[model samples]
Target chain A: MTVQEKSWKEIPPAGICWKPSTEYLTGDWKTYKPIMDSEKCTRCTLCVIFCPDGAIHWNPGKEDIEFDYDFCKGCGICANECPTKAIEMKLE
Target chain B: MFSEWKFTAKDIAEKADLFMSGHRACAGCAAATVMRLVLKAVRGPIIATSATGCMEVVSSIYPYTSWATPWIHTAFENVAANASGIEAALKILKKKGRIKQQRIDVIAFAGDGGTYDIGIQALSGAVERGHDFLYVLYDNEAYMNTGIQRSGGTPHGASTTTSPAGTVIPGKVQYKKPIADIMVAHDMPYVATASPHYWRDLITKARKGIEVDGPAFLHTFAPCPRGWRSDPSKSIEISRIAVETCIFPLWEAINGEYQLSAPSKVIALRPERKKPVREYLKMQGRFRHLFTPKFEKIIDEIQQLTDKRWQRLLKKCGIV
Candidate 1:
């Protein structure tokens, strides 16, 4: 039997859903992407430490982490934690 | 067309109105307020499993009515267990297309007696099993439903039928159980402690907890006006004082990182903390024991412990 057939129930909805917004730290979904400044990159990993959700990432080859918007709560931990000022909490 | 409090008249009527009027809950029951706030966030067709306590007895008197949502009144120790069964069944039924989306969330409500003492093991088991549900403990610091006996959540010097103050024995020998700490130990996805005095905070925390992946626990300080023998209106004020005094800190733990949500500073910085504990204790009959010198020492110890915790929180939050 298929997963659905075997369980006789639908798959549960993924845990968190994001609501978009505007304003400086309002976390508007469409207006912004969590941008990282590669020039000041230290790859020190403090940004990842502060992220409420595990959305911030570090790429060893590119020498910087990326923010995954799908799961990010937009709590701005990364920007607050960036030691080199590489992560600025952009408007979104 | 008008608004009473924040809820529009239409909002009150049109919403589930789950905690209906004319129940036997004592005048100014804080747990009822908790239920009202909880209903605001969780739309039905939902199921609530309530353990036997003031809320259960008062709201669900056999035959006389109260709850608007589908609810199961279970033993004092089985609220979480029953809720888990409901949630598990709903999941299976939903996969088979037997239930609808609104029917997905099941909530378990318990009192301090149920949550901190009797029902703790069952709650821990269900949470560890990773059930998709929410457990709300309306803590009044004692078993108010059963003649105001001391439960695990009773404050240090609070007089209860069980731990009454006298010449030799002091009131409520043990400090309140750290329920949030216990839940955090389970590594649940979301855990929060909120008070009805903070409506927005309470609602936000409940919504977030429900939205999380696994079992989420919310421990709420629902002051018992009768059991506390305080003016009903002061329930909110007393709870607010508790938070300000760091006697009850409003915080949340998600995946083990603690976030200090209220005050954000040590009690010393908040002028309210300067208010004598007498302001809080004088309002409650439970603390009437403070009249004696022997019992007064417990009050001092409680204050010192609260100050220490507040200082630690401030230092950790870098607010000190």
Candidate 2:
């Protein structure tokens, strides 16, 4: 038997629906990215608080915060409410 | 009469303390209980892949971990794929005589969001390839990890954050995806649906799946107190009502033969079934608007559809 197998076709995520509680944007989430500006960030932690998946993280020593796009849903609450022009949305 | 039976020492041994008391799940999370039960049924070297959902978040919060086993967390849609990699690696290692014992079982744990919606194709492929692994779908009806979001497993006529009830529209508008039937359609080695409410039936089915040679899939109806808007205390009762009302029938399919574990318990009338659904809905802030007629019709439709499906299941089980 060959060790190589057929490549798996990526499954699309379920689109928006109302019947269930929340319509998670399923599909390839990797296509979108959440951009954060450390220069303008006040470090109030609003993005961290509002993020559902806990994708944003803060570094205490360097005073730099990071948003891991691997899990970010790109809901835009952070960019919408950023006290400074810190967070921006990106589609990768 | 049932109280006379005592839990034996061997039973306790079989039931390991994999999940100690201090783990942080919701007040009444059926999925947490399910994790305990599933881990108890399997021993030896095993790797578990879980999608991003309530169970993953609650059990594996950063800086605090609840699982005693080697578990991996990937994206929501690739749990099966991750498990496939783990299984393939283990298989190749065992075949090459590199790993001793060679008894690791690859398993994937997912909620309705990961299983029915995002992860279906990968899961289908893995099962179709006949990999020796297990997949457990812990269906809480909707996506609870993201603050009661809707998913494919959400039933019709239930109000969710997306499908709110008002004077004009009430509750969700679609039926749940028939995932079990879909799996059986693949002609997989084993397929079964059980609920934590039925412990003996669930444990038995898990045992059966473990013994099966090829791929196995188990769909579990796990209720969510926080998401379903039900009292924390009534989590188990609501799960029982779900089966008793025929909302979920416990059954198994082995090599295309269908066998129902038990008959759906029939109640007096629609009102009896409606009582628990209503009680469950009323406690949650999400369904507070269902007092109007639009909401009433949603419940009515749900009751009607469940009754029809229950009858069909009975026919399938050769009861009617």
Candidate 3:
């Protein structure tokens, strides 16, 4: 349902759905991108657990967590919290 | 103990996007930052409800919302009541085989005006009934959306539009309502105070609150640059200073068992760790009127109050 609809019911205008806010690409707000190197990774998942935003996806298929740059705001919490310094911020 | 606190900006960025950017929150608003941090821990489908306030007004407007999960903007008061109804409906829908809504988190978000004042009755009723939901109070210390009117959560001696500092009076004459303590007094399963600067602690407490089988209340310290007349970029820094100064002590209660957070625990262990309150008070324009020598007494009074509260908290944590 469009939120543009004048009525207050759930329509596109309301933008209320079971899905999350995945459509908004917030990467432009960041001046840096966190680059994760799996070779030095510990996989404790602390970064994943502690990330204020759900930008890290635990890709068991890749045997490491992956970052969707589209969502990361480059707050650097993950890089700072990484026990082994596996995640590094690369300037855009 | 400060050395033990782990989560940093990077750890938090990994879990981004429950509340995305491109929305209308003023730059560097602590309330918006607090919302991002709190929304990080929902591991599954969640339904969030916000009471009318800055968060409700700024984040969700018609045809656009920052929320990625299902959200409902309820009226100013009775947010908890609406959440309770949602929780009940979830159970009934599941019972009737209408919807498999299992594991869906039901959360209510509100500002101090909605929580400590307008919504207090509904909050009390919802908690008393043992509704399974989490209530997050993003307290920015005043009615910031309506131009910085003093609120029940406003700290003592801080100036606001309503509590203007002048020759007749210093600022707000009364102390904060101890809203979190009142929530604890309700005999709930969990209650905690958090700040966005302590991202790890804040996130863990929120996750615990939402995951609990019954009611959980999280009183977050949200600093408002506009309301405080402070620097916008220092939003996180302001919360950091509040914790460091022991003015906004962080602690949690689980089934009546109280434990001070790491930083506060350090202060409890070593009273010497407490910083003077002037740095915090002087940084905000709301407290600017008290900077003069004539108002020095008010600063001392505030310092005394902070020490007393810290001592009281230490005693409860059994660290004294």
Q: DockQ numbers for every candidate? A: 0.01, 0.02, 0.13
Ranking by TM-score: 3, 1, 2
Candidate 3: residue B306 lDDT (0-100): 89
State the TM-score for model 1: 0.71
Model number with the top DockQ: 3
B20-135 per-residue lDDT for model 1 (tens digits): 54455654466766777776676446778899888888765533446766778889888888988998898888889876574567888999999988998899889988998989
Q: What's the lDDT of the predicted structure labeled candidate 3?
A: 0.80
* TM-score of the A-chain for all models: 0.57, 0.61, 0.75
The sequence of per-residue lDDT tens digits that candidate 2 reaches over residues A1-92 is 12442333432233211121112222234444668776787776545433333345555566556675544544454565466858776777
Ranked by DockQ, top first: 3, 2, 1
Question: Better model by DockQ, 2 or 3?
Answer: 3
Error of 2 at B72 (Å): 1.2
- Number of the top TM-score candidate: 3
Better of 1 and 2 by TM-score: 1
The complex in candidate 2 yields a DockQ of 0.02
The TM-score of predicted model 2 comes to 0.70
* Candidate order, lDDT descending: 3, 1, 2
Native interface contacts kept by each candidate, as a fraction: 0.00, 0.00, 0.09
Say which prediction, candidate 1 or candidate 3, comes out ahead on lDDT: 3
Cα displacement (Å) at residue A84, model 3:
17
Candidate 1: stretches off by over 4 Å: A1-92, B1-16, B263-276, B315-320
